[model samples]
Target: MDTAISPELATKAERDDLLTLGVEEEYLLVDAVEPRAAEAVDAVFAEVPGELRDGVQHEYYRTQIEVASPPQLELDELAAALLRLRSGVAAAAERAGVRLVAVGTAPATGQNARIVDNERYHRMRQRFGDLSPGQGMCGTHVHVSIPDPETGVRVLNHLRPWLPVLQAATANSPLFGGRDTGYASWRSMMWERWPTVGPTPYLRSHEHYLTLIGDLEASGAMLDAGMLYWYARLSATYPTVEIRMGDVMPTADDAVLLAALARALVGTLLHEVRAGIEAPDVEHPLLMAAHWRAAHDGLEGLNIDMATREPRPAWRLLRQLFDYVRPELERHGDLATVTALMGRLHEHGTGAARQRAMLASGASVGDVVDELARATRGEPGNPPID
Candidate 1:
């Protein structure tokens, strides 16, 4: 698509410490009895404090709600802020006779469920019909702010190969449609039917991105730039690269770990680009293959090397990648927490693994929903919410 950035922009002197972080989490609003997204965010919003309420917004379906953390330099603080916001939202939902559950996809969603009736959502429904129905998927979005558009594009390009590893680490959806989907991350496969919703094509520059967006706009393939729902893409609105890979984490600790890894990777890639080293280019075809593996097997999948196009066990590749980015995580002060949780994720398995184990042992979807609710609330028995 000829997305090369101009030479002048690429050659400009790099800025120092060009990365900041933020997070966006989507949640399902469930009726206390059933684990499904509830159409009650508008009512719940009124109960949250104004200061803690600004960035909270509705999702494609009224049944889902989203909260965004303020931009922060400290990863731990960012995680805490998100947890606080989540707690507030949950409490408000409870007061309104609804509850909040954090998971990639709700177990009880169906085609008969209602979509948010806003102009934008209605337009999308009109355009895509049942393809864009209320799927009740929840996700955690990590934002790494770059110094400029060129750097954003560069970091986005370089990080494409490692996304599947991160996805495997955070795999949390083992059930969908009130039964086992038989995929580690059912959410990963669920969103692929949209026009531009998977791993994006590699772009060389900001201009290249502009051209692609321009083409999508000109061709009416998308309503505007906002509809280009790539799994990992450079944000046109915020000056950040958004990694929409992970599921809605099962616990706050898992969420923090995902954020730490993402920020470290972005920081390291930016450092490498500034040092005039060529960023590693993973084969796009291999990345697509690995993504499918991550969706099906989660941590158990055999990940293919993007450069060599050779298969390796997901655990082995994840550990190798962690070693390479460990320095960056250390420098950012997230090393200990990130490393600890990486081990925990491996030992306990991703959310998908945990959910599958729970179900196989006789827990129903309602039980899974209750567990997710407790995890989100930072209850005593559960791991601390991030």
Candidate 2:
């Protein structure tokens, strides 16, 4: 628990605008009756108001819808925006005769997801068939402000191992194809099927980043620069570094906690760069292995140690992760919320754990969606998670 940051950064004038952040979450639209995936995203969009219509968009699957929050300085402001987005989307979906559920994957699976009628989506399904149909998954993405691409590259390089910690913290997909997958986040495994996905190969410089992405696009494996699905990347459309590793957390409060950690990680990495601290030289394969362990095990099992790149208890890795960002979190006045979230992590476990616990108590897959749908709109749920 060192709250110490680089003295060089301490002396620099603090900018009120340094910590801007935004969150994007995708959700599955399900039939209200049997809790099966439903292809009603267009109908729901029609019900949305013209003012908030632009913020919601169609996903790869017609059953999936995405909502994005405007950039906000404080975590509370971001949470408020997300709540409104979720409620609006949920109300629209309800009116459209489908329920909006925010689990990482559809609980009552086995049916193929209907593909949206878009040219880009058509190409994706044509190129990657089975993967596209089973891709009825959702994830919570956070974007933290980075001054420029140079700093973004540095932050991404420093963020490799810790990305798994984010995975461990937000594991939510436990059921796939209507059966227990025995993995915390099956959505993470589904994402790996894409050609240009997973850990970026430590692009140390902005020039290096372009070369890496350029080679992938040239190879025809990825159709465009946007298809390079690194868990973390410099945003193509914004002055921010995007963390795309987490599943859609069950509640808006949980999503805000993930966003706060993302901002703290960015701030800490920027300060590390200023302090002349180099990112650890863990190989890309090792980094991929770490991500696998985290996605498979979540907080209830072992995680790869960032310093040594070896197996260790998940709690140990999680603790070390917080210590690295404690300084940045304190500076942003987010330490209290993060600390309380850690407590909830232990009590309620991850969303994946809660899903399984409900099943263990004889709740069916449909019942799991019932619990998830309620929590999706920031409503109170059983076991009373904070």
Candidate 3:
């Protein structure tokens, strides 16, 4: 992999225009011994340290908790904050007599998640019907600062084709109902059952982007702008391009890897916009197929190459993505970190693969869940895969 910075960027001083980024990682609360999803979010939240409470919040379901990092300009700072918050939250779950596991979905058999006691959540359940109970699926969202809606929408266009590769790198949910689902990220498959969760359509301009959001809401396909769960979108509340393609990673380091790539991708797209480069007009159907393939295979098998419309080794496509964003990674002082993390991903495999390995090695589903809980707390007993 040739990751050298191009000569034009090399001659200039390292660009001072690094984008600010933040991460939101959702975690599942499970029984410490039985491996079932635990309805202990309220209990756990009460135990969170005062200093870390702001970053901790409840998810759509009581079985999950979400941690949001403050916007940061540096990757190391983000890493430190995420680690501190994750460790703190894990401690709180322990105090609450439950375990926090970062798997993408509940792995135990015959477990059902209950909605939190929020009016809006109840409305969602009433309207969405059967889809509400499966809301326990967890994902990681990366928000990278953008200058304006126009640039953010364009970045979404450029980001469309690469979303599957990102999803493949973060495919962590392989077990559910006490068995391997034969899919890398079953949470993604479950998520796509929602009306508005798939690839973002090609936008002609910023106006077109706004128009579509309104249309989707008016047509009842989405309840609100918040429900526009496209793989990438301009955040409704934040002035950032949000990438919602990956699963909740197993470790803080894994989340950091995702943030690094997402920020670099945005930076690369901003440069392209300035240089008058047009975003690719990738087909929507092909994009959807790619996402399915990614959730099925992860990095251990083949992924659809959008450019060739043929299957390629997922890792090679990942390399291509890394190469495409190399200049931005180099400019932002993230090259070494990304390189090392990617190596770690290569050696350890995705969380789904690791979980399956444990299951195959005579460990029961409950044992796997216990190990994941220990890994979530960064304890010495379990090796890290993030």
Per-residue lDDT over 62-178 for candidate 3, one digit per residue giving the tens place of the 0 to 100 score: 999999888776789888888888899999998999889999988887457788999878877777887745528999999988888998888888898889999999999998888
lDDT by residue (25-82, candidate 2, tens digit) is 9999989787789888889999987667767889989899999887776677778889
Of 1 and 2, the candidate ranking higher by lDDT: 2
- Candidate 1, residues 1-386, lDDT tens digits: the string is 11122234333313334356778888888888887666787788777777677658788877788888776666677768877888888898888888888888877655545787789888878877777455577888888877788888888778888888788877778787788888888877877777777776788788998899999878766788888877688877677789997788877777887888888888888888898777676666777788888888888677776667788888888888888788888776777887788888877777887777777777778888887787777664433222
Worst 10 residues of 2 by lDDT: 1-10
Model 1 segments beyond 4 Å from truth? 1-18, 109-111, 382-386
- In angstroms, the error of model 3 at 12 is 18
The lDDT values for all models are 0.77, 0.83, 0.86
**Candidate achieving the largest lDDT:** 3
Instruction: Arrange candidates, best TM-score first.
Output: 3, 2, 1
TM-score: model 3 vs. ground truth: 0.94
Which candidate model has the greater TM-score, 1 or 2?
2
Q: TM-score of predicted model 1?
A: 0.91
1 versus 3: better lDDT goes to: 3
Q: Least lDDT summed over 10 consecutive residues: which range in candidate 3?
A: 1-10
